[model samples]
Target: MEYEPAEYQKLQVRQYAPRELRETAEGKYWRQFKAPIVAKQFGGVTHIDFCQQYPYNLAVTASTRVIIYNGLAPAVVGRTISRFKDIAYSGCFRSDGRLVCAGGQDGVVQVFDANSRSVLRQFKLHKRATRVARFGADKLHVLSGSDDVTVRWWDVSAGSQVLRLDGHRDYVRAAAASPASSDTWLTGSYDHTVKLWDVRAGGSAMLSLEHGAPVEDVAFFPSGSIAVTAGGNCLCVWDLLGGGGGRLLKRLDNFQKTVTCVRLSPLAGPDSAAAPRMLAGSLDGHVKIFELDSFLVTHASKYPAPVMSLGLSPDCRLLAVGMADGNLSVRKHARPKRAGVGAGPGAPEPRQRRAPRLTAANYRYFIRGQNSRAAASDYRVVRQRQVRLQAYDRMLRQFRYRESLDAALATRQPEVVASVLEELAARGGLAGALGGRDAEGLLPLLRHLVKYIAEPRYTRLLAGMAHRLLDTYSGVVGTAPAVDKALGVLRDRLAEELGVQDQLSGLAGALEPLLAASLAGALF
Candidate 1:
């Protein structure tokens, strides 16, 4: 005969647990980057830019120098340009990766040859500090913005300013050259306005729009038909082909601090035909990526300090963030090597496999009871396990309901007691198990009921048990002092819970009118 083990009762899940954040494709892709490599500078990192050509060198502008880092070996410094006597700003590379240009605190824009680190050209026209500088689409011209409230275009072949636009009343801090055309440029100013300029036209702006806050940075979509502006805490998108002045397509206010930089994802990847994404960094130490079409935030990353500038490589293999604390963090993704494939030039070699030991020829390997070992084709017997039960379970199996309840209570586990009580109720023996209990035996049950009756998870079951308890002990209430005191405490707790429910109902009623009014106004 075989003995069967009694099944353990499962406890009900009553508490609410918050759901975890769902991981998206964008999150998985971005999370492939390994831990960042941090570098410290003399002062805050004002700007970071990656070259468009092969090797994809990174240019970082800080205090009084521009440091060029090898893209493949990010921890290695390839070149340093320290020609600026004062602070340098917005150091960026040309499309060919041969020339670098940046603005200076001395109101000068200088271009340096990447190989020799020599200054090739300098445009010195602005009266105040020149803060923004970048190479134009043609790679032969440079565009610069200054604190003197002007935007100047310079020719690299000849050291001369080609075009100057002077419509901004405040300092121009942000500028971008269109990817589709060499004649068009976008500039953002502290006057809360973004102006689009075409060099073929006059010096005045061709189109202007109010940003409602001081503009920090601006970018143009690859098609040149859409523009994005970053201001106070908002990123705005505009349609350039919409009516006369263009229309505001969307206003995304997702950050609590100023948005300092905005950039578009690379358009040269295999997924280039897919909808593009916009990346924005804020002083809140977060960089959020949003879908251009839906404007929904798909992923986000947190930095140690406020992010002042950030750049993504052309191949999207590296992410560089410059912080206000002078920390430059660079993250790179390492692709997994396929089995049986050769490693790349700098990849580490695969580990060697060790040969197995000659165990069959060793006498000790077989002498220690090894002859009793079973062969692969041999059959074996498995012994059945003996069942073990707890004291409460054993009592319940014997149909001693009262003793089982006592054992469950002595365990001091609320779930165990609740399970026993539920089992007794299901078997239609609850009244008999609870009967014939003196004041000392009934005190624990009363205390447990009083403590848990207010909880929504146990209210329905516990409240019915409390009613039955009162009906059974109505005649003996005054005789037992401890039992009488517990009943009084339970009465007070129920009254307090009722009062809380009434107050919550009143609050809900008060908020109804305001919500209705807001909904009505939105519809109208």
Candidate 2:
């Protein structure tokens, strides 16, 4: 049977997409909004680090278990992972990757050689939890930020504390090293200020940003001329250039929620365009991206938990988000394309498509006005391309989504065309698009495949394209005929898979991040 939708059937697409996707999609339709990052959960993401150079990352659990994953699949790092006795508040890798250290809640800093995956050295630094560890370029200095209200510098080779900076009067939430100068370090605290200090230069702050709440994270842009701090519900930007002390740029207040994590693109350079980009995970469960010179949310991504921590790939393309659930969402972020950017003169124009990883239950679709046009010629051409794509999609899905997404992005496939048509006609995308969209036949075929193929979770990479169309209609309106037909389709589709939760408690504590931005003051 051929995949063709009746004029009436095409309108039914409104319900086939998942409720989470719909809520976001509907919100997008209201305004030509920039996308916040969409987050994927990683093994109950307690902490995350992108320094390892792979989608592979290290995340910690409340009990101090460190789990590692190589982007899509996960593997426990070592047999001696973290136990109740040796675990504590802070942990990080040395620049050479040979040594990784963790601060124990019991007031000890222990270093482990990752190659052997064994503890190398242990030094008791405080009476309480020592929260963080970092190695400075000058191999002589190792910095530890702690809840003990003091930042200590240790000579790694000497195995002793060389100096202790006591400026911060509250539990230090985060600490960072300056890119160009290892002698420099910055720390943010619950006391609402960030202090910069030099281990060699004696005492006092070199610079400070007086925010009003706990500053959860701090980072320096790759260029070394700017630094950012996330506190309360605002991301305060500062300039680290010019004579003497750096000054505040401005604060982005739209987040309307506390920011739990902050990171700067590690691969930035000196050109103004090369200015480092910032990515943040929030109490609201959204990862927001900020371009340095201009302080605005260039894009946003969503996750389902309080995004307490995040780190970026060495290349700045993948973002590893650590959610409260201990799941690390290794997601690909869109890299900035400088003008005059070209793939190749002879290569085919890249067709816009949904992300290579998309789960129908939590997927986002983008249909351009031109793409969704009722033109038969356009449909025919797209239909031809989607045909081949359908065959490949089946093979990939069968592989438990372990297959690389390179294939989904390899050709100019009309996947969007096939998928939208299927959903409109009551056929799901996974099986229905692979098979043709014949109303009667498509539904039965989907039922068979549904039993065998479990869907992968999808994060929205690009949603504004379809939202642009939804915007024209104003809250899902259409011509009288189109509206009636769309309702019929939405109604039937919703009845089948659209579940609703009448009680918020059933949604669970996991959804806290999802509500944070909307209820900032009430909870925190």
Candidate 3:
């Protein structure tokens, strides 16, 4: 006669709360960027910009120099423009990628030839430090914002100031030129306001919007109908169209520190069908990517220090982050190769084809059923695998309840012990199982209960088991020294757990009034 094995009971799984950030396709795409290539600079990296042409070199402004890095090999410094006598800011490339411009602490804005590294033009009209400088969309003009609370337009050919707009009451630090028109541009100032200017309209700003905080940076949508401003811990979106004053479209306050930079993805091209994303870097060392349509964070990356500036390459293949610690970290995403194309010069050689194997008539072909595959209509024989019962399961099969509990306890697995306890309780034999145990037999169980009773997962089951044990063994407690000691330990542990819960409740109660007052003030 064949013996049947007892079935193992399945244990209940512990569930956890869902995380705020989930793994999505966009997150996976961002994760494909490999570990960064870190480069140290003499001073904090103030700005980073990638040229909009082939070979897309990057211009990084730091200390008193603007360093040009090869776009394909970001770790290599292609050229350095060290002509600035003072610290430089906002090093950027012209549309043609042949020229680079940067503002200096000496209140000068200079343009340099990318290949020659010679100053092509210099404008020193501002009375204070020029913090922002970039080429306009037309490529013939330059725009600059300075600490003098003024914005200036410059002619590259004549090396002279074309126009000066002075509406901002404080330092003008952030600026962006409109992609649709060369005459239109915007500036964000420390006065907590963003103003849009059109050279054709006048020397005055055509539109102005209050940002509610010291403005750090500004960016325009490709269509030029919308704009975004970065300020204290927030990004504000404004509608630039039908205008008494530009209307606020949305306010994004997901950051915990000041937002230092904001940029739209695919910076050098027309908008694609896929909704454009906004990239924002903050002093909290986080770079967050948000979908323009939904305005929800799609992905985020953390840096080692506060991110002062960041740039995504025009091709979207490179991401460079500038930190306050003077570290420049660049991460690159390798493009997937086509079906049969080799990756590069170092790709592995193709495997050679081997000679055909021996025919089925050979004994070696059939030795291990190596080529056997069942056909759709063929009848197949199924073999049953022998079941192996655990010690507790074997003991339970024989109806030895106390021995099964002892066996479960010997395994030292909490889940297995809990499952066995639940099985005994379901059969109406839990009390019987726990009964008839001597001091030596019951000490392990008591210790396990004491250790796990306060755990949320096993609390309810262990508590009931503990109560039953105390009731059954109340008369036998003082007879055994070990049992009495365990009981005292259990009492102390329960008291500590109760004290923690009481303190937590008191803290929550104290916070309630303050929360209510803040909510009321916000509502009013």
Candidate 4:
């Protein structure tokens, strides 16, 4: 047997904000497609990153464990590497995505095989907590920053220290590898400065640029000629091309809270002349995407709690936000309007395979170059149109008599007509609904009410309407067969009810004299 949904489940679902209201730029940017897919965590998420290639797996660092998730289906954890002796703060995937690396509070950086969950290399050089670590462009070295105020590089093959660049006055928080060249990178520190590093040359830093506040996160543009840093509610972009150290390209300060993380879109590349967008995650649970050329926030969204980290899949279809409440929120784009093996826009329509009796509507549609399947879908019949009664019920409760009566009459349904009449009587709106209606327009509702004139629940409300309708259309009733029959039935039911009332009145009249006689005898 095949499974089927219940009847109530087959009703059409509506969007929270329909398409007509989202024509403006701001409206489209803020519209939420759907509810987020949530994954619970034992501790707050600290860092997240997606693989550089297809399948685009996710690496998340939380508490003392680093977990890997299949980006395509995030409901399950692929692997959990909990061998860390202390809290793990940051994690990233290598360019090939075959290995995952993380920095921990135990003053060590460890790299593990993506599938085996076994540590491939562990660098124990930092004296204090390691803040960030990621693979370099060469994929043979691991770069890390630590609370010891130093950024260090370790050779993955040798599993030993390559160089230690120490210049920051405070802990280093964020770092990024340059994609255009393997020898260069950038680091941001709480010391309120961002330093450019070149491992090929032995020095503290190739160049240092001053920022007025502590740096929380940093990212390099696709061309490696620009860099962005997030800190203290502001984002600063620098141009690294001029003869001087570097020039300030732009400063974005619209956020109301500190910006904790910044990431460049994976779609950005060096060859593209158009300015690419970057994402900024803040402590206020809001994420903003800014275009580099205009320095304007083009899109924004909110999470359930303060966003601790953010990542986007390689295909740009999936976005993951890690929140302070220990929940991961994943959002997806809407599916295309038409999708099938050969159903894309402008695809040639398939010819008719069989002949059947066709209607004028379908014939005209196909003649206009529309697909037969699409035309048939437009004329499909709906079995449960009663769901629209909810809207009428709302109007009646609000005393919108004109709208309620029109909707009830359109359906010619007994239950709906009776409901509208009862509400009109209760709210004193019968005159407003039917005061000036013509005979033809009011015939359907009158016929439905006369059929149910004997039921107690509907009798009182229907009787008043039947009398008012007859008074308006009495002379013309004989011209229409349906109207004449309904009028005769209504008259007979009303007369029968009046006969019962007369009998009850006479019995009360006789009992009144008997009661008076009994009272006089008692007094004597």
After superposing candidate 4, which stretches have Cα over 4 Å from the reference?
1-33, 268-275, 336-524
- What overall lDDT, based on C-alpha atoms, would model 2 receive against the true structure? 0.58
CA shift of 511, model 1, Å: 14
Give the alpha carbon lDDT tens digit for every residue of 424-514 in model 3. Answer: 9888889889998899988999899888899877899899999999999999889999999999999999999999999999999999999
lDDT of 1 at 184: 90
Candidates ranked by TM-score: 3, 1, 4, 2
RMSD, one per candidate, in order = 9.1, 18.1, 6.8, 19.6
The local distance difference test score of each candidate is 0.86, 0.58, 0.87, 0.78
Give the CA lDDT, 0 to 100, for residue 331 in model 4.
71
Better of 1 and 4 by lDDT: 1
Instruction: Please give, for residues 208-297, the per-residue lDDT of candidate 1 as tens digits.
Output: 999999999999888998999999999999997798897899999999899999988764321343476788999999999888768998
Model 4 lDDT tens row, 276-373: 56889998989988777687877788776999898876645567889888998877544311222212233334455685556675766457544435
TM-score of each: 0.66, 0.55, 0.72, 0.61
Q: Determine which window of 10 residues in candidate 1 has minimal summed lDDT.
A: 336-345
User: What is candidate 2's lDDT per residue for 190-260, written digit by digit as tens?
Assistant: 88989888778857777776877898888887767777888888887777775367788777785757888
Write the number of the candidate with greater TM-score, choosing between 2 and 3. 3
Model 1, residue pairs in steric clash: none
